[model samples]
Target: MPHTISGFSKLSKSEKIEWLLNTYFTDKDSARALVKQYWNTDDKLQKLHDEFIENTITNYYLPLGVAPNFLINKTIYTIPMAIEESSVVAAASKAAKFWLDRGGFKAEVLSTEKIGQVHFIYKGGFDKLEAFFKNVKPKLISDTASITKNMERRGGGILDIQLRNKSEDLPNYYQLHATFETLDAMGANFINTCLEQFATTFKNEALLFKDFTGDESNISIVMSILSNYVPQCLVRAEVSCKIEDLKSKDIPNPEEFAEKFKQAVSIAEVEPYRAVTHNKGIMNGIDAVVLATGNDFRAVEAGVHAYAAKDGTYSSLTHCSITDGIFKFWIVIPLALGTVGGLTSLHPLVKFSMEMLQKPTAKDLMKIVSVAGLAQNFGAVKSLTTTGIQEGHMKMHLMNILNQFEAADTEKVTLIEHFKTNIVTHSSVVEAITKIRESGNFK
Candidate 1:
């Protein structure tokens, strides 16, 4: 049968699903039922979700969990996390509690400057182009007045604009690099709007300049878009305590544990293979909170990873040090987040998540998110340097294994007890289940 169909997007939701089932499924009824099972019960809510994207099927869900006892900047918070990977929330919570009595976490917003660019190719002398940019800079700002009017009233608008020459990197290529203080919103649309206006005004003004020839005047606009590499939009989060105070059940010898932890971080700092995984652990915490709060996790991830590689070599976003008898672990990361636009007011659960954190501003949210990454890194490093990373992780993963095998309730209980004293692995769990069934001890 031919699978291609025109106007598929024009079909109604039911029709779309019917087409999909007929085209793709061997068991059409079971596939249809499974798709419907994930739909929202409320029609209005379902419609809203469907409109969020094109060809929307049922909503995909991630478990929303809360990790409590996050004492950041001397304020207590129970941070909400939306993630599917096992043990992330649990790890963050354990780290939070470990530092709760050690003066908790400290976070501060270092800066909040985002960036955008207007790219064009002009086959002309650099001197003439430089003079043209200097003359037309005011016009570029003035042309975007309408778009920046409301943002300026809110105390945030275009910060500055610069003309960058890139002839060496790419012949006849240059850029109008602009900076912005977006305040509480991620401001992608705002920045792109201003860049487009700047592009229009720059090209228009060039045509009128006597310093430009017709070819130069006809500057070809390559593109105008916001860059996701926000090095200036930075936040720092750290936790520090006396080395002697780092005592816990997991760290009987605080000195030995602290040294090993510092060495672990050091290895990641210079080794890209280890650094990638190390930063991923940090983002597991960062992305969860970013998602729960309805911010753009993809943008955040891109900016952060770029910043990690900014020093020319990909390195860890987190660091640890021991100085003056104190052990300090910290992370400096780039996060461009918003709390007043996009999904903040639209999604009910996002609103709930905002209120759960006492309604933080963008800066406040940045601080909170940085602390989460720091705490998560600390927990992971602590585990790795001490008892190893697999012990607790596999235990948390046992339930997933049990579910994959479709174990009954009583069988799960028995297996849960059995694994408490034994190591949990896929093969081990499968062997235990097989033996239990063969012994006729389970129904």
Candidate 2:
């Protein structure tokens, strides 16, 4: 069935969402049925809902439009993100156009695997602990079956056991990062529960185990820590276009943009303070999609930030290079997400975002998330490189300002996009937009 309303702009926001719904589900019945299966909290779900609700200062998630012209792994995609930051969407859209002409970005992802650590801090020889894990992993893994019998029955349980000796830089911190194939589900509860039980074995082996993990290592053992971050997975995006395409368009200095982009990334890599915010700008495009999908945005944020500071110093997650006058961009992130779990089964908008993501596998989802971060980073770095941030950001920011002033949608967007392109002076753009607002149309 077609949308109950035709033209998208004429529909209410909820109606527009309903129209979007038509694109994904076979019918309204299917979509509505999912809501009942997922979000319906008659009694059992209500108790679960009550378990975690708090008053918070969260913003209304606005759709960040990352334009068409993106080709990933020979697949054309116009990825849409939900973000409010200025220039991020436009810049990514712009980069996509540049890449599209060059046969799009070539991408490859390894797997859709995520590691959940059940950290057991011990006051013993790190070597002894490492040897214990290496010697008894098979027994340990077999023992996992009884613990996750229910999960095993549900087709998800201990898939791999990985032991890593934490660097002496962090004392008594030997992390047991358990790899789980959470198949169509988020594995927080399953992974953490299995690890907590495994801790008892170490306690029985070495009496010091419980005490060391107890406090001296400052471990109270927080559970249900869901990880959207995985190990450093590889991702690549590249664009090759004729130099004339840029010069022919007469869109300011192209060479300058390349040089500045490199320098900005270098700066972001060197300074932790700068890297935090720079990476946050990258996440503005990423978290929006994560939010729109009802995935845990907070976990993604913490993981990305932690990954940024991984080297004892902070650095950019993306790296750039200029080869044969073709600018190439690459980024690696531990984006462990799934399309079959949590809100992917519940929310209507999550279904919409998932469609926009083009049916990403658990691995594919991480690849796309990395692309979003890199694409957004390229846009920001490009803007800062060729034109100061203001040239690219001011226009979208005006829309933010207009919305703050309660301007209507029609006048708000039109004036903002128009003034961005033709502004001679700030005073003129502001006055012209204000006058247009008074006249009820931008023209």
Candidate 3:
């Protein structure tokens, strides 16, 4: 069994690796060689990567790709995507190209509001608590003046504060609900700092309130944190064209295709099972951009999924419709993103991605991300309703299958050509490669 050691993080890199190998591995030498093999040869870059997180080991990389020809808000852009999935970039690129000629995509930000809360318990009269809150509200705002000064200069700061009573739901539970406008920053730290200050001020003032007699004045703070749910931080992106223009060589009947697409979205809107997978396809695009830009994809994912189920049942994030000879597809999602803070300033690739995006503001980034999701959903729904998702997905996955079988360059070339007309499956590709090797074909 492995044993814990003190000062593990304080150890040098080599020492940490040595301790790890000795603690767990029988073949320490070979394991040590394998770990060192992934280290960057450039010392400075490797050092930078090592310092990015705690207990550093080595860098793990994902492919950073670009999908071109994305036209949003009348401007063309090439989006950077960092992902390991086989077909995500391809699917997004195809969708972008498809809509590029059909009026492109229109995107707009609906709002930019974020939230945080301070939960506490006070077994006090509700009316008295309300009066006390009103008395102290100005102090709560004034106490955080220093914290909000810079944000205020940038035209973004505390927006509102409210006292919410939830004693009926949970015994003596109350919350100080706060909202903020962080401008270009995600502002989790700012919101959290303000919340903690508010909590402190609330507790301090409660002890001095003359009306509170006993435990009513003894407020116990539960927690103070920023909420990942930002329903108002929403952006909308859509693509629309005349129904007649929806005709394609693969899908020749524009009217029928449009109807099928609408029905497909309708089913996802009502069915939880389909909605989960359906929204995941949208996130495959959204998350790629979010990760590439150094924003928190995990938070975006949580908030978006919650928004999808906001109506009591999980539903599709993307919607489609047809009216008066026009076919339309769109998605509106809540995304609390930043362009000026966190990894955006530290990560080299993140900085490059922001530059490539023409240094968009926070609102601009929201619109671009929304468009990515809409484009991705278009690609998925188009494939699902017509040729089936596997045809394109497996074709894109063929190279991975070939690499798994350890096919040589020449063999891979021939197989690529052969699979162009043939179906691609793990078993079929393996069997074909075996036959080619057995026949003494081009080595």
Candidate 4:
């Protein structure tokens, strides 16, 4: 019974919601009520949220949890994470506390370079195209002076541009590959603007170039955009301590634990299947911080995963080693983040998250974010090598299962105490709940 609607975007927010309810829902009143319940109580704040995106709708909420005791570079921090998944915040906190006494994490930024490209089809000889590009490269830089002026003042702007011929892969395909130094901002708009200008200037100059033939003069601009695969914008974070100092409740056998942890990382390095999940654990921390701070998690994910496979095979982003009596765990990742632009200045929670971190610049944010990923990976690998992943994960997931079964307050209290000494699983919890209900054990 689906049908198309006209001028959907032009409709008012209420009108759009009405159309959606009428078109899709069997229980329209319930659906409408549920949507309205999530809206902000303050009308002005609600209006702000609505204007953030098209087809203004109710806000989706996530728990904004903070993991404390992260001692990165001799300074303590409590990192904010906005994610729905259970156990992530707990794991990060546990890892941070564990490392707090073990010399803490050290982090540094390696680079801050971002990339963009002007992909086009030039039906011309390579030599002629090369000559035309060389002649137009300076113009490409100069023509974007208006756009680059402010960025240049902030110590970030266009770095270099080169002609890339892709004739072997496809006929008459080429690129104006460019690199940029976009200091603090993610600079998507800035990079894209520069690339479009480059494309325009290149194409316009090609038309006047005596080297290009009649067909070669027509440079077909396919697209101009920024690349999310920023391998050069990297940061490294590490934690190291003596092997004996690693002994704790979870890791009683420090030597064995160190070897096992290293072996787990090694397996992930060679096994694609294991590497994907291993890196996902790392992202649980990275993406949480990224989202909480109003940066692009998707871009970070794409870039990190690509960096993992940059060696021709997908491998672990983290590495572990034990030399002499010292145990070291580390991760180096590409994170093109910002703190002054985009959502950092707009969203209320984003501003709070930024302030909570003492208002870090892009490089400082990179170091902190990298430390988060490393801390998360360490916690995951430690759990995987010792008690296994499910025990802690299932314990954290117990409340969700309880809510799904709709257990009463008293039932929850009793069952929680009982499960403290017993195994936790869906069927077992359900069975226990059934027994309590059938026995009428309410005191």
Q: Which candidate has the top score in lDDT? A: 1
For model 3, the local distance difference test gives 0.93
- Of 3 and 4, the candidate ahead on lDDT is 3
Would you estimate the TM-scores of all the predictions?
A: 0.98, 0.70, 0.97, 0.98
The residue-by-residue lDDT of candidate 1 on 166-280, one tens digit each, is 9899999999999999999999999999999999999888889998986888889999999999999999999999999999888899999899999999999999999999999
lDDT of 3 by residue, 150-169 (tens): 99999999999999989899
Off by over 4 Å in 2: 1-61, 64-66, 110-113, 121-137, 146-175, 183-186, 204-229, 233-256, 407-443
In model 1, the runs with Cα more than 4 Å from the true position are 440-443
Q: Which ten residues in a row have the lowest lDDT in candidate 1?
A: 434-443
- Evaluate residue 336 in candidate 3 and report its C-alpha lDDT on the 0 to 100 scale: 99
Q: Please report how far candidate 4 places residue 159 from its true position, in Å.
A: 0.8
Each model's C-alpha lDDT?
Answer: 0.94, 0.64, 0.93, 0.92
The full ranking of all candidates by TM-score, starting with the best, is: 1, 4, 3, 2
Clashing pairs in 3: none
lDDT of 4 by residue, 44-140 (tens): 9899899888887699999999999999999999999999888899999999999999999999999998999999998778888888888888899
Listed per candidate, the RMSD to the true structure in angstroms reads: 1.3, 11.2, 1.5, 1.3
